[model samples]
Target: MTPSRFLRSALAGLLLAAGTAGAVPTASVPEFSDWPAGTAPAEVGRRVAENFAARSFQWQTDPKRRYVIYPEICAWYGALTVAGLSGDTALRDRLYAKYDVLLTPEGAARVSPDAHVDYRIFGVVPLEFQVQGRGDAWRAIGLTYADAQWGNPVIADGVSPEARWWIDDMYMLPILQVQAYRASRQAKYLDRAALTMAAYLDKLQQPNGLFLHAPDSPFYWGRGNGWVAAGMAELLRDLPADHPHHARILAGYRAMMAALLPVQGTDGLWKQLVDKPESWGETSATGMFTFALVTGVKSGWLNAKDYAPAARRAWLALVAHLDDDANLAEVCVGTDKARKTTKSDDLKVQYDFYQARPRRSGDLHGQAPVLWTASALLR
Candidate 1:
């Protein structure tokens, strides 16, 4: 079904609210047509991309910490490589150095139990570099990282390999698996990659449609589901139509997406609690979903005209949150939803700490979302 175009309905209201407050002369949405060329899509994306890039650093590492294996760094690299292609070779070089730590002679990563599951590094990075259309080396750094981390199998610190969570296995690992599968034409890597999500797919179900994190975890962290959705978006490159599981994978993606449609907030963005509806609006998750849903529809895995408006509305809502520098604001920082049991990072965040906090427009964890959102807007 065709969706209706969004009326610039919120523009006048927002402008009026700003007028009485003696704020900067805010323009109505209708006046968006009259705005200078500086606020175009490419420019905003460029600005946010620049802001996100500046924060892009070695995760958990500084000049003082020295270098070490970090999964979050790989996540950063997966998106960073695409971004740096235009001019950020310096940032790309930083990722290349990190990838160098994991690549093995066997053409796969050498992940250790030293860190978490960052399995999808393979599908996103190219292991073998061709020299002017010659010399393709199938040495896979993304896969090698996965193995090195999983090989040692850490269980004592807090989590264990047997303690399976779905999203990481589904999205992070499959990206690399598909990348390897395409390069080697080996069914084994693809098979293992396909199996990674089985546990999660089998276990994930919410009465309203959004997939829950794990069997025991009920709170549906928006970004958690975003990872799964984005991974599915990336998987289209490798999975063939006749592959045994292709149909099922698509089915699962739609089921998860269907769960998202009903919960979009009136402002055109999703709430912090996707299923909870009443939770405050959150940009990181909303932006991610907006990216996935739009990309999914464009890919034909979802219906475009029907869903893109929500994406557009959410995107329009998202546009309003930017600062003069085009940087984003009010995104939630990283937190583990599984740690709901104790007074961990959650309750310890006292108002004393909150109220006295430095005034800022961005958070560390919002980097990926900004990157991801720019990708969506640019598309």
Candidate 2:
């Protein structure tokens, strides 16, 4: 059934199940009216980045939660990148101060060997520190994270050549792999990055060029796909022209961009469920997709005329969501996999679920990508 029909049916079903006609409260969802004019993409990016960087870098989470959380870690990366872009040394130093505890010998020791991959994302920060001539502690943590990933158990999926397929792996794994290669000049690091990414696309990428969140869970959650796009963009930036995976990765990146072009909302943002237009426009995914497209155009991997306009539109759309305080609106909080079963009675993620997911302002997931997008547009 068409998305609208399915949505109407789902809402009707929900109302019936509640045994009430008008009990469920509803709000008039706003649409993207018109985009702001004349602001350069880089400037728009700086506004978002500076607003984030100038803050205390605190998200009101528990102090203990600061050490290895993905959203916080990723947002710091964004702020750091923006500092590099805007030459905001004070902002950069503030970030270092905020996250300094994690860089200590004690903090490095806190990186548990058995920790899940999400925790290892902080490794990329240490690698960045090492590049700036910081002590070996950072490099040690990064390499350890890489080793754990290399030794991670492979799961059986008929199409994947290596381990299990998770869309989040796209962003989760690549930076460390690339940074490892940068630090060691080793092909193996690059090889692992490429092979796993290839395996993911092999199994999860749809014929139309978008990806399902996972092999078993077929939903295309917006941020999940954003991770893939943003991750591929990172990998492509570091991947060598002569490498075996270059052509395929380039093709996959371009294919995903092509798929995204036709679906951009009139407001220049993408829906929470990218393929589901009836869903609300999501800021984080929109920023990531904009960053990827702009990166592709900057790298000459995509036709400038064809892709740049859309990238600009998406960037402008993203800009509209950024409040004067620099908080991003309509960012979906961290999500888990939806049910895999195809039972007809299943309440699949449609308009309501996507819309109902929390809309927090200044979320790092939303914060980080605007920096990436700005950095991409800077070029």
Candidate 3:
């Protein structure tokens, strides 16, 4: 057998022998059906999914030079998954049609050719399409980006060439690689994600179970940590229990969840700067945390009694923030890591930077997590 294939076979044998395969529950235990008005998972998911389908592609800069940005990719992926989970074929078809536009000459010109993490995450939408049985073409296209992530000869700390310790990469990088594994059933893709995650957990996870924006940036930026929480939940959902890195990944996920439980606001939201009482409630991080918590409780990775209520509270609270147009409010604007300006500046400067970020309604960054949380509830 080929080396990769042989390794996969060996892992399968180990899983079966150890009986850890299928040990983790894949479905929610309590089946979260008791949502308040306008808060039902399916109802909210469809609203957000439809919103994404009807919108024009978002861009980082000039509309003329537009390429699919990561935020759009995130919302698109969430919409596709929600369609499949809710069994809404019409919604799925609409999403597919939207993607088909990307294949046209005009649309193809808009696909970003950059090798950066944000650009590379565009691969996830196609990979999700492949998993939904769209076609072989998507699998082929998606793998190109996944493979290119590792194509650079230079490697840092034995992870992907794209690995930067920025907490956002925890979601951006792993979700793409995990989706590639789902589409292709390639163990290498899964291994790459696990290794990358372990490296991040070792470097970024703080003593309090939260993560900093970066090594030098010591503040608990909520959206940044939200990326880590959601990424770990996504990876743990698919990673085999027998994989060498599974235990460590699970430990990290559980630790983060435990830490998040106490800090959730009385209103069921988390703030832009999570640990700061003065920071305003932010929807993107709250939605991401809700998704992670709901997934954990459903998958039996967390005690339903402890996490289920928190998850439900978070979902309801998040939905309450949604407007008539399905736009979530109070989303923190996209932020780069806050760096120290001078030797005299303390960590409060970084904390203030996060608190001062403006909030917007209907941002894809916030919308994507709502869809994801909705899907988790339904799944």
Candidate 4:
């Protein structure tokens, strides 16, 4: 079945369970009729999806890694999502065909063997294929990564051995497990994701509601917090309200959203160092935050009257950064959290490191969130 069909069946099941047709809950999809001329969700979604479809598989260029990196996997997942949400069968088929290559021996070689958070996140693509009515093979391949993440005998504080308390894991870990739950309807996957998020919240979330890059790294790095926002929003979309961790996760998400409201650039972008006025506006973070806000408003976690305009403004501003080729500009290059040293000058060095990072166009980090935002708008 197509994604639209799957959605309809899911909704039908929900309605049947409610025992009254009038009691059914539905998510509202915002119409693009009133959006700016060129920034409509459909237009931008199609452009980015086509750009992705036309590209060759991307691998890590630095250190010359052999496997496909997480950013490309993320972009691929987003394209698949927008394809399904928009009911673009041709785009859907094209994406599936691309994924089919990875199932082959030659293509499997491109998949990483490591269990690092970045590598494990590749599972999200195949699990997404499974959600769209693909075969069990996709689920099997996807679950191997998800299950292995917890395979270590020494999990600490209910967190995965892979957990490093880096804010990026906020999105990396939970999204994979959540997709696992969606495919299998297994409580373990959801439990793992929810418990892990709660732990991260306790470790990293700040009084200002944004996350630091790490517990010791004091600055609010834009993409790092973006990961937190997107991850929470994705988990909430599927997490049952009665679940033990739901309220905590919801409170964390709302707090982050409230914090973001005041910092959005007048141009609708957010800066690389989110709290620093002098930091350059960054595309990837803006896109990720837009997805979070759009998801929140649609899910009624946030009031439309309060968040809808911000979401719309963000989408328009982000699309304006996309070049004719559909590549987003002013994206901060891939960043690693700074390690605190004994030197007293360390904090300033770390802060300058973020401020001085190179801005590139067409990075998968930037590309992925634009597709994510589009998918959220359509969802």
* Best candidate, lDDT: 3
TM-score of each: 0.66, 0.80, 0.90, 0.89
Please give the CA lDDT of all the candidate structures: 0.51, 0.69, 0.84, 0.83
List, residue by residue over 244-327, the lDDT tens digit for candidate 4: 887778777877888899998999899999998789899999999999988887777776767777887888889999999999
Q: Which model, 2 or 4, shows the larger lDDT? A: 4
How does model 2 fare in lDDT?
0.69
lDDT of 2 by residue, 1-379 (tens): 7554454344434323422111111111111122356356546656766676565534234566434467766776766666666766766676666656545775645544444557667667667656545566767767877766666445552222223357888888777777777666678888888877776665566766788765445667899999999989988877876777766676677668878998999999988889988878998999899889877766656666677778777877777777777678888887666543232224454334545778778778888898887776654
lDDT of 1 by residue, 43-70 (tens): 5555655554454334234545332232
Question: What is candidate 1's local distance difference test score?
Answer: 0.51
Which lDDT tens digits does candidate 3 get at residues 45-129?
A: 9999999999877642456647888999999999999999999999999998987778788888788888889999989988999
Q: Please report the candidate that would top TM-score against the real structure.
A: 3
Question: Would you list the clashing residue pairs of candidate 4?
Answer: none
Candidate 4: list runs displaced more than 4 Å: 1-33, 60-63, 153-155, 340-345
- Please give the lDDT score at residue 214 for candidate 2: 56
For model 2, the run of ten residues with the poorest summed lDDT? 23-32
Candidate 1 structure, TM-score to reference: 0.66
Taking the candidates one at a time, how many backbone clashes does each contain?
22, 2, 0, 0
Error (Å) of candidate 4 at residue 352 is 1.7
